[model samples]
Target: MLSIEPLNQADIPVTASLHRDNLRLGLFPKLGRHFLGLYQQSFASSPYGIALVARDEGTVVGALFGTTSNAEHYRWVTRNFGSKLALAGCSAMLTRPQVALDFACTRAGRYAKGIARHVGLTPSGSSGPKAASRPVSVLSHIVTDVNARRRGVGRRLIQGFASHATLLGIHRALLVTEEGGLGTPFFERLGCRLVGQHKSQDGATLREYRLIFDEEGAYEDRDGGRVAYTVVRAYPKRLGPASTRPQRP
Candidate 1:
């Protein structure tokens, strides 16, 4: 049986490993599995974060990490895991000069600005009056094991995420992916609207997608199936054996 539920502490290692192995487009995976583990931990521990996993029997096959408030979540992560993440990142840069070069070329300035804003060294830009009417959650990361593809794991995980967000009174969610990337069509099929396009610091074309929850209390999939928004609670018992190996999807 396949089940979708909130991520738990024990699932961190598998989730991190899956992230490191499967999601290779960004800089985080190059930082190594330990760094990814702490990254996932930050999400699991943050009040504004949402972490969900899809499990078959007892092994995790897919995972999703998001935040209700990007700004607040960044601050929470910086306050709690900044030092550890910096150390891990430094270690990665030392061992892999290419990763160092990539960071310097791409993320250094953005990260610096984020840190400055987190510590109040930089002023947050004006929110304007319309900011109150816009409550957009972020869908940070989502991935599924290769072996689990075509089995509805990704769809269920997304649906479960939407359901959880709705329970939190969040009706809008946003995500960004590389333009024309493998996941782009998948997201489109799920009814995400293309809101904008921009270039990343690394020069990759990035596409922004927004998903709006309907007032009728259900989200319609591409197949015309209407899935009601309802949270899938975690199982009371711990997971079983951990021998299952994951393949990239």
Candidate 2:
């Protein structure tokens, strides 16, 4: 049986467990308790952050979690991080270690130099002066137990997330995930169109996509706020699916 519900404390253990198995299978390291604890906290914090679980029989097989920052959240997040901050230098390196070592070093240097010219590291030329006035939502997490994959659990989770966006009156939602995975196909099926792709040494690719609802809500309209997009990336490097003719199950 499959069930969809808002996530609560009780579901954290199961959600984290599923998250663990899916990524570690691809040579990813197991997350320590501290990270897992933080993960749960962040997942629950997003104003529109929501979770849904799919169960096969009595076992939890999949989960979807995401967030949408409202006007208030956009104000808070931007005020602190302010456009073009320097603190993320280490994270940029950690996430893209596979690039040419020299290139990575140069990019880091460039990232630092470019900061003064850019506000909030945002694509918009303006980021600071328009903080609290805008509303944004960030969809942050999604995972499925490996053993239960290929069974539409992922697709259903996407639907659940869309439903949340619909409820929030958000006409659109954003999330980034590993490219060409089960999750990709699932999102595409649900009207989530691919917006862009970013790649790095670990063979990790961040694919950003947006899902727009029929008539519920819309994204943040603040002056300098941003669109919060959930990022679901944690997979082992592997040969992509072959071009072999499709075989019906």
Candidate 3:
């Protein structure tokens, strides 16, 4: 039987390995060790973080990191992930300078924009959902084990995460993926609609998809079964009061 559970500390190494082995995002495989851990920790340590893992016969087959508020999430990440990234970057520089340099250069623009948003130079809605101030949920670093791809692993993982968001009163869950990538169709099939498109710093096009739970109370797949997964939320200890967004199942 497959089960969804809150990600625990012991699961990190295996889940990180899964991300390295399966996810094909640019620079992910190159700095998989450091970057995956950083992303997971950024979410895990945040007050708004919602981390989950899917287990089959005691092994992790899929995992995801989510947050109810990007603004608060980014603030925590900026304050906490900086030193760790610098240290990791320094280590990569010594062994693989070219790869390290390329990764750093590519991320320069994103870091600048993040800073602009934090400092208020990039106004809300300037970059659409990326800068939206309204209550929003971010789905980040979602991946399924290559060996377990088509057995409903990804769907269960997403449904589990979305259920958690619904419990927290967040209606909009969004993620960005490379255009024409496997994730595009996967997310679309789960009822996430394409909302916008933008170019990455390296000029690759990316599409943003949003699953509005309010509009999609429960989705009917082509087979006519309602998508469903059960998630048990640990008591939420948010950094602030919960969002005022209307709750919907």
Candidate 4:
């Protein structure tokens, strides 16, 4: 049967490969291996992030990657980076409106951060508009292999995280996905409702969604066992057991 678990040292290559291949299929950075490696390093090492993968027997076939973030966790990116983006856009307009067009997408990407960061512009002693705050659980990202689509692999991987979050007693689980893409409908059907919509730093529009979870849910793999994949990640020794072989076809 297919099983899901957190990604660790052994699964790096699998996560990296799936991430790279997905990028090639139109995800992000769209860069070659060099940049992909850089991304892998960050993703693998980030304590705030987690990657869950699905295996059929011993073969790695699907994955779901996510980052853990609190409400204030967006400070660095939104305030500083996004403010720079807004400034750059304004400067572009003052000099060349055409150049400003280039930053239109950039500003939109930073809009959420712009909103978040501006709360700090006022002096600390002065009563200013408070930064937005609310109860939040760990944030995450998710992906599945294209070849393995529609057989419930994505569901398996995502549900794995849901179970993990529930066990951790995290009441809310949040994630972002392209609003109109394959993931949109998928998440919606799974009971995650849209919470917000925004543009990306690269001008792509995205939707944020969340779900209230109970730890009692069970995650089952529909793949029935090992799923085939062009690439695979290694198992985290700290996790329970290594994937096992499926019955012969």
Candidate 5:
């Protein structure tokens, strides 16, 4: 039987491995498995973070990491694991010089702010975007093992994450994935709407999607647990002209 639940500390290593193996397009994956482990640990440790895993008979088959407040989660990670993560990052960069260049071109400034936030060099309010009165959580990463693909593992993990987010008073969840990537259709199939598109630090075009939860209805998983929201609407806006409009799943 497959089960979706909060990720335990003991499972961090496996979750990190899954991330490294399946989510290779991201910068964190290139930082190596140790860095990925710490990254997952930050989510597992943060109060505002959501870390979950899908297990089949006690073996981890999929994982999801997200944050209710990105600013708070980053602050917590910087305060608690700053030095260690920095050391690991530096070590990785030293061994892989191209990684260093990629970081400089993409994430250097944001990371600098994180460091400044940790040392009180910057005001708390300036860490990132100011928090809204209502919560809007971010779905940062979700991946399933190769053997688990097409078996509903990814869907279960998403439902589990959304259920947890709703319990925290979040009415909507946001995520960004590579344009036309494998994840786009999957998210669209689950009723996420493509809200916008932007270029990443590395100049790759990324698409942002939002999943709005209807508080009145719910979805039940195979295990009979209620997923707090059901996707009921369709994508009404088009990203381009009718000739180029993406098809719905």
Candidate 6:
């Protein structure tokens, strides 16, 4: 039987190793470790972090991690893990210069604008547009052991995260994945709607999927347990095409 629960400190290393081995990003030996360090700081040890792990007979089989507030969580990660990230950045620049350049270029616009806002050149609310005020949560990472696939592990892990967010009074959750990658279809099958699309630093197309919680409708007396939720489908004004929109139960 597969069971989901809060990720323990002892399991973090295994989770990081899975991330590196399963989702290679063309980094060197030590760089991968540093990358995992960033994930660890953001999702495992950070006070604002929320993470879940799936186990089968005491063996770790899958994991998911995210934050309730992107803005606050990012600030905390940068402040606490800044040095480690800097070292990793420097190493990547020296070793994989092109990759580093591409990443920097891709994120430059957003960071530059953010910096400008911080310096009072552009006030936070001065912008004419802003994301919806709904408390948006992020599922930054989700990985399942290869042997554990096709056994509802991924779905249950996601369900566990959703339950956590729901209990915390968050009503929306989102995640970014490569558009044509394996995760896209999986998320779609799990009832997450594609809300946005963009290109990644490596030029790969990325799609954003959102799962909205129906607080009242998600519960009921069903088989002596709560009702399984079916999220509502809604298109964000910023995104195009409703063809790939998610379905409501």
Which candidate number has the best lDDT? 1
The residue-by-residue lDDT of candidate 3 on 1-249, one tens digit each, is 899888887888888888778776666456657666776766777888888899999999899888988777776676677668657756756687777688678886776778667656766444553234355678876888888888888877776776788787675678999897889887766656677999976687999876555433323233334353321121112111223433333
- Model 5 scores a TM of 0.81
Residue-by-residue lDDT tens digits, candidate 2, 42-132: 4565454566677777667777766655334434333444332223433443554643354455455654444533434545443564553
lDDT of each: 0.78, 0.53, 0.70, 0.53, 0.77, 0.67
Candidate 6 lDDT: 0.67
TM-score of each model, in listed order: 0.83, 0.57, 0.76, 0.57, 0.81, 0.73
Q: Please, what are the lDDT tens digits per residue for candidate 1 over residues 1-249?
A: 999988998998899889998886678998988899889989889998999999999889999999887878888898888999999999989999998998998789899998988878888764654553445589999999989998889878877777787688776678999887778887776666777999877688999987654333223233334454431112101111112223212
Tens digit of lDDT per residue, candidate 6, span 159-212? 777677667767567789887777888877666777799876567788988765
Stretches > 4 Å off in candidate 1:
216-249
Off by over 4 Å in 5: 117-120, 123-131, 216-249
The lowest-lDDT stretch of 10 consecutive residues in candidate 6 is: 234-243
Ranking by TM-score: 1, 5, 3, 6, 2, 4
Worst 10 residues of 1 by lDDT: 231-240
Quality of model 4 by C-alpha lDDT = 0.53
Which of the two, 1 or 5, has more TM-score?
1
The all-Cα superposition gives candidate 2 an RMSD in Å to the true structure of: 11.7
Q: How are the candidates ranked when ordered by lDDT, highest leading? A: 1, 5, 3, 6, 2, 4
The number of clashing residue pairs in each candidate reads 3, 18, 0, 13, 0, 0
Candidate number achieving the greatest TM-score relative to the actual structure? 1
| Positional deviation of residue 249's Cα in model 2 after best superposition, in angstroms | 46
> Which RMSD values do the candidates have, in order?
10.3, 11.7, 9.1, 13.0, 9.4, 8.9
TM-score of 6: 0.73
